[model samples]
Target chain A: MHKTALFLAAALLACAAHAAAPKPAKPARSAADVLKDSPTSDWRALDPDNTLLMDLAAGQVIIELAPRFAPAHAANIRALAHGGYWDGLAIVRVQDNFVTQWGDPDGDDAAKARPLPAGASPKLPAEFSVPIERIGKSAGFTKLPDVDGWAPRAGFAQGFPVAADPRTGQAWLAHCYGMVGAGRSDAVDSSNGTELYVVIGHAPRGLDLNITVVGRVLKGMELLSALPRGTGAMGFYDKPEQRVGIQHVRLLADVPVAERPALQVLKTDSTTWQQLLDARRFRGGWYVHSPAHVDICSAGVPTRPAP
Target chain B: MHKTALFLAAALLACAAHAAAPKPAKPARSAADVLKDSPTSDWRALDPDNTLLMDLAAGQVIIELAPRFAPAHAANIRALAHGGYWDGLAIVRVQDNFVTQWGDPDGDDAAKARPLPAGASPKLPAEFSVPIERIGKSAGFTKLPDVDGWAPRAGFAQGFPVAADPRTGQAWLAHCYGMVGAGRSDAVDSSNGTELYVVIGHAPRGLDLNITVVGRVLKGMELLSALPRGTGAMGFYDKPEQRVGIQHVRLLADVPVAERPALQVLKTDSTTWQQLLDARRFRGGWYVHSPAHVDICSAGVPTRPAP
Candidate 1:
């Protein structure tokens, strides 16, 4: 809705102002322009320790964790990773326009549940919300210039999309597409960082600050996104054969250094990133008209092979 | 961004006034409360002329057109509907975290392209935006209380989700999940309403006001939403056998009266609708904490058997 207003306002202003002042016209800067002029320092390197590489038959997906936000879940997840908790698990749910969840398929039943590996916490306090102080000053939270109906401030923090409430002094990662969150039952504390789901449809912002978001799928999102929708309740595959098997999930540090994914996420604080946002904000050349506002989720973060 | 500021300001004002007064024993009213108190006169019924009934293997899907927003495309689509253009076409693309598109599988090749049947326009002006005057005063264009990065005023106009600019008096539909749009090539004017796509992922606001959005799938979205993703670029199926055939798409009025779907969408401007919105805006009972703001796309428009 915020983006809708910005888009209309920007377009109207441009059209009206352009007609009123035809000569020596100054063009409005697009999101791309802002990114183009941004300094390289705005970018940050991905911490390999915080990265997880999920290999599938199609390709490998890179996920960077938000340990600063969900430290406990991140730690437990790390333990699960090191212990190969998900090596034999399968993506058991692919609900169209909703999510794709993966974990121990038998976790739902208490009788046949998989045991938590050593180092993994059997239970932990819900890491849904955290103190805003944990968000480092250098996180490059380029706050969206528009107003949001959901949070006091909505923007990128430490390369992860986030929303915060100044009044509550609480901040949390938003449930944008590709964002990975720990799955839970009716109980708020039911999640144990073993069962996880990645948002694969509309940004379920409603889930923001309500669940612990561990990381975001940086690559191979297409592979997971393309999985067949499950037939059971909430998109769970009723039959075990309906699920897609996961080849493996390995931490970059655990693998041979040379075999790790060579990747770099564009620094959110860098000028290049700002320019990228601007470019998308203001469509040029081929675009007959440009939208004035850009939603935090609509903005794309560039990634590439490490230089 | 705009919504965030408004919420903060409101919260601040509420806090300041309550600082001196004893906390009221009653629950705090939410944005939904403001809407629930709206008069009954604000509500309106769906226009049968602008409605379409799409019967799928799973169930029925109802779509309401925004003729004022995209007249040319709507007209072309209506013609196609009458001519049974999509009677045997299939849903050919299901791009993960993106869209579910339906159209002639051979649209790319001119030789295989089906000619616009009698009464259908082979070429029509892109109906991306329309004059604001056409949107009536009784349209209930209550702008969202937030600032959008995309449009001047993002809100509902006559029960249809819309974006507008007061300055230019231009308005168009926003592309949210379940919203349908005409599919086209790189050429801005290529779409003639024969091919259609539905937003099934995060609101692709970038496409807002860029393409012609005809209507939204009112039900059975999961049927199309859950399809397997195509392997080809843009999520096109690599093999011809992969396409899911469309049994037929007929206007509800054209079908036998006894065969019509007995469904009704919650009147967007109704008190019940406002209460639903409030319920979501201030999820209280089970929720540990509620998100201060809710995205328009996430708002529920209830559907059930007509009384």
Candidate 2:
């Protein structure tokens, strides 16, 4: 059977309708096919120590912390999770075409605010971007072919979407869909990892280098993205009941090995990753016009269930 | 009082936490502030004949068709609405990070399919892009300052996101968030505007010239963006019951005058729109490192309820 249009269901059904039509010219391999042909070495399992499991009523959201990019924020998040700081908090905001934020709803009130857990600092140096040297010589940065408006260069840095400045010699995580950040106040050092927001819409590249991006959601983004939009200002829920409760958050390392999610991400440095990018950049299957360019965010890193 | 952190809800509450603190340094105006100061003439009311209201259990989605871009598809959609072709159909697909698609769930089955309503075509010459001359000299094309990798140039044509290639003398509607498109099969001219989908997540620019983008949803995007993801292939619901029922679809012109939504979109050619773009490109409040560029999609055309 002819391959389905990757983006549209109607196209899939329409292709089915032409069952008697002669086979069209052989289509080029798709990104899915490239992944299928990848070697096992091309995929890497999530590091439990740097992984976060956010449990909600709907399902678990797996986040891979990019400590290399924002070590302070990542460490703060670990401390908060270890202390069970976010066990009973709720997702208080779901802004359409923007972000879904979760933290303490009463955090604004001094009298009602929850105290920070042990080892978590209220004020820390903002890790908006790390020095190029910090990532080390073997950071595995796969540069994109196209230019990005937000940064001098954009590509994948160790499996995470990244933007870099050659002149400044600094690199930061790009705010692509599912990329998570530490929410801060007017002061650059105000964030303590208590408040977190994930990019759920278009790549808000403007946010790049302005906030401490600590990680990206690897799985179960649907749980956060599909939540009802909050009705109040900045998409804050009008009532407490409207907030979706976060049952608990745990470092995957803290969870039993058997309970940990079996997730694997394609290595950005692998040949298979390049093949996948090429497949997307060049037209195949149902694609008519070959968009020879692929934005770094659009060429998303592939993740899958472990075999 | 200070402007809240535009992207992070925690920043809003954090500002509240510092109520008694000394006033922070003066911050620059935000996009919201720019819109607040915009002149009444900078806004244009939606043309009733070109506007579509899709009623669902959640709420209504308002789409403004761009007849200047895809005349045939727009006319076919108008006819479909006139005959109530989509009155009882269900939204069959909700692909995370992609689109929310709706049409006849039985469209693929010849025996079960409902015939196209009177005057609606089953095939259409793909209006993927048009000669630049078609838009006329007064088309109000406001080019973006940043270069887009997907096209030679990207900007706002009138109030809609658009991409143009001056070398080819062609321009097309861009695949921005909330932009709606006609779904097609392997054949280039397979779509007839019956199966429509809306971009609900990141801007899938790769789909720009590959599909017929008929219009864009101006309001109530949360209604479509927050729908549950379909479990079946291509984000199609596995079971029919899981699909969200469409109460009805109607042209704003066909509705009673009092029943029509009083909506207005920011004119792209206005000085206020340019100021808004600059405000986003040159960050001030709560920003440490200013990203001096903004993608065309990020520089979204604003819309709001009429005064």
Candidate 3:
């Protein structure tokens, strides 16, 4: 019995010594590892109904529409897209450090204005916000801790940056660079989705919950963001010849399968995503110090090929 | 006595009536009024020594150097400019939504490298930050109240977005879109102002206090920002044929006075500036609702002829 007790004591001491000694640090993981380790359920396919493919001279830009917040605007946009309303329209506005707008340049004149194609709505209720309850239960939202002077609560929902107000039970999209919104005139409900603009500079959150944001340009932002600044007020092209003509805008499903570009977006709700965010938030090696927090707009959503 | 008391009572009643009656709202002032109202002391002309003019195919891009933050780098840059180092160089790097870089395309090869002319330094210290106390009063700072994720306090000083830490008493230029900085390799101090880059996307504040920000592109940003993205890594031109050759970069003083472009920047410290900020922060007419606060970056600095 004495020998057995002594043996147990010795084992305990050995275990304690091992715990005190430093162990080899775990190997650093690449961004790819974090995404791969994410659960399969976190991955979501792009909804064909909410996707827009803007074909440009260089390539195509994929836009993911947000109908949950801007239902009226999104519906009108869908009608316009289906009717091929913007098939040959030109990008008529390119404001430096502001926005790149596209529509019927002659829409202001009554006689020369292009009529809204059949099935397309000429008007839409400013669908800027919707009740928070209407947002899907599995939408995946992580609130940002920092204070945003523009919104009551700012964070990420699914893969997009969002703002919410519990008091009003309302939620809407926050205006970040690359975000797409419908252009309007003096009237609040003037937008019909035929005219659109994309934020290209600082996040114009003032436009948040004010205009109808339909979607975000996922890829090929350069094709639009790099256009020459217009000399006219609000970045409108003064000369009729200054506008860059659009060939066509078609849905990916409507296009031939061989022409469709294979693209994949990193799932925002996955643990891999959390790791990626953490990595961005906390810099290692050359970075002398790590930022304890990160703004939702600064956390970039990675894009690449699907396995 | 009775007459005096009656007169006093009547005057009091008139004052009370005036206070009770709602005063007519003031007329909306233009951005020009905002600058005109500013104290002359607040307005300072651009220093010819610290300014650079890059003549492009479209027009000239004026850049104001921040020597206080990057003295060593700025000095080297000034020397390079005076020596006409970039007279025959080329814009060889353009990364979409990232940066547009310009430098000697053959810089990497020791045998083919261009030699630094007289008064130019081959080596320079990484002048990323300086004492904050020297800013504003001495360095011409105009602070803005906003939450900056990268620094304790952030504001504009001498037409530049700046980040400062009161605790450490250090300040550096913030990396905003169109902001120009010297590029370097793995060595933190490798840059000698020969290679330079401009931020072309979302403000990479992560790079603040980590690099030498020389200046900002005051004009003709479209010429650089609109260039096609290079197919090589870090946006380097894969072939010599892909590079866009530089015409010349010179100080406005060096050019003939008749050739100088008439330009003026809005005085940031003026009352008109505050009014403009307020107008943008809380848009009244067209907007039904307005954001009470505005990010420092979102503020627009108008440039026009000095009327």
Candidate 4:
């Protein structure tokens, strides 16, 4: 097994997958392997209207909104972005293995906080969850073979990781890495989509059906995920200077045509996705044991530059 | 939820469980709640000999070695730390959603790398997986009731997160956030414990049994996880100045007794631990549905300031 002496080579997060332990004399074909052979039809382009171009000092992060799941929040977020709501705001909290929150730091103080722009609202109906039946055709759910402890079924839906209860015909977004959600108070209906957070580490699945999952970061996650964690409790920066200022959060539609993120995500219902799932379910090669199972968060859906 | 319009307050990752949404009108009481009632006997102090106090400019990170799983690798790591082999080294790679690597940046080049100290061996047999039967009484295995897709069983051994294959009677470390592993080439035995990395985001379980996992970072993970991600391919810094300098990696035994980390980890096999597990499996209040199941990675054993 000591074939290569490239110390830094194996340290990379390889996208390739394996077959099973005591592997055959050939390389095991996994996710990376399957993806390379996927048909072009399996990949879909991002919709500019439903996309966000979050420009920070480090780089740009692209997010895709889920209008079908949380219509009011989605509309408000789009309106806020259209009104240049987050231009001067700063990322205020980065709880390790949890989330990175951003908004007006003085949002709590009525006198000091930045007032909501014309299109933005102070409150909206809690879209924490919705009936699966209402999700309709755009829902696009593909349940995992393995059962989840959190939901009756777990899988990808409408291009977002989601958990569903077949018994109640209910469904909503699941909080996997890069998934975005609205920040709210103890009251379930408190969030107005002004403040938002991105899941930066573990998938706090418990957050499912408890908050408004607005969108997901499709690219440039490191810009937010790798920022210095807040020293203050729950990962809040102790000082104002530590927070990274948000340069602009323009909706893709508002940005110049050439400046938009030219990206595409693999469709969850495509044949390539099924191949990726199979490869993950039976990894071999360097693996001593084939998990024969894959976790909802661990099986990351691949994203790439549009060809 | 709009009890107060504290923007930053609601944005921070709050652990206070919700208690509404058709819930049982009572506190679900998970680890955050049961931890308050844990007995002193349920927690164990960190043994100086098995601990590595990694001093960085940001702060100190303490790692507890898993000697039971990889004895040779552990011994080599201890020897390297005791000899100050890693002092002045720099963290060279920070792959978001993957790992943070630290070691001799010139490790791959035989001409420029730091030589291993006297007691450290350059070549050690791979300890990727071992027969469970050989595990001594010190290796405590507590299997979770929920099923896993990765291994036959998921549990903790010697307080380290682990996966086991009962058929082959083998067990090894399960990759989780904070797990520390030696960086290697493609070779199975390329690592000598000098180049190491810690999981900073999602658990790359595919690396399990493919590399040598030595220990786990018990504290100061944010110091590594939150570092600026390198723009270079594979998250390596293109410029030498981008790396974070390491001060010293002194073994606990080498440090002055007065300066040791006064900390203890909650025992995994204790009744208190079981209660915490039950709480996670059946969380109710504020929860729309209790996921009677929990992932092995999500069931992180707690570590806290020793009373």
Full-model lDDT for every candidate: 0.70, 0.81, 0.69, 0.77
- Give TM-score, chain B, model 2: 0.90
Candidate number with greatest lDDT? 2
Model 4 misplaced regions, further than 4 Å: A1-33, A134-138, A282-289, B1-33, B134-138, B284-289
Q: For model 2, give the interface RMSD.
A: 7.8
Native A-B interface contacts kept, per candidate: 0.44, 0.65, 0.35, 0.48
Best by DockQ: 4
Clashes of 4: 14
Q: What class would a CAPRI assessor give candidate 3's docking? A: incorrect
Worst 10 residues of 3 chain A by lDDT: A1-10
Runs with alpha carbons beyond 4 Å of true place in candidate 3: A1-28, A32-41, A134-136, A256-259, A285-289, B1-42
Cα-based RMSD of candidate 2: 7.9
Question: What DockQ, on C-alphas, does every prediction get?
Answer: 0.32, 0.36, 0.21, 0.38
Worst 10 residues of 1 chain B by lDDT: B1-10
Give the alpha carbon lDDT tens digit for every residue of A1-307 in model 2. Answer: 0233322111111112112222324454566767787899999999988999999999999999998998888888898898888999999999998999999999989899878889887777888888876544488887775656566667787889888776788888999999999888888777778899998899888788778899999999999999999999879899999999999999998999999888999999888887776666555567776565667788778898998
Residue B32 deviation, candidate 3, in Å? 5.5
Candidate 3 clashing pairs, residues 3+ apart or interchain:
B34-B272, B136-B141
lDDT per residue (tens digit) for residues B1-307 in model 1:
0011011122212112112222223354444444445454544444556777776666666777777788888877877877888877888888876788988887778999766678998677788877776655666565555334456566666566777766788888888889999876556787888898888888887787677788888777877776777888778888989898887887655777777777666566565555554455444433555554445676645555554
The list of candidate 2 runs beyond 4 A from truth reads A1-28, B1-29
lDDT per residue for candidate 1 within A20-78, as digits (tens), equals 21221244455434544445555556677888888877778888888888888889888
Q: Predictions ranked by TM-score, top down?
A: 2, 4, 3, 1
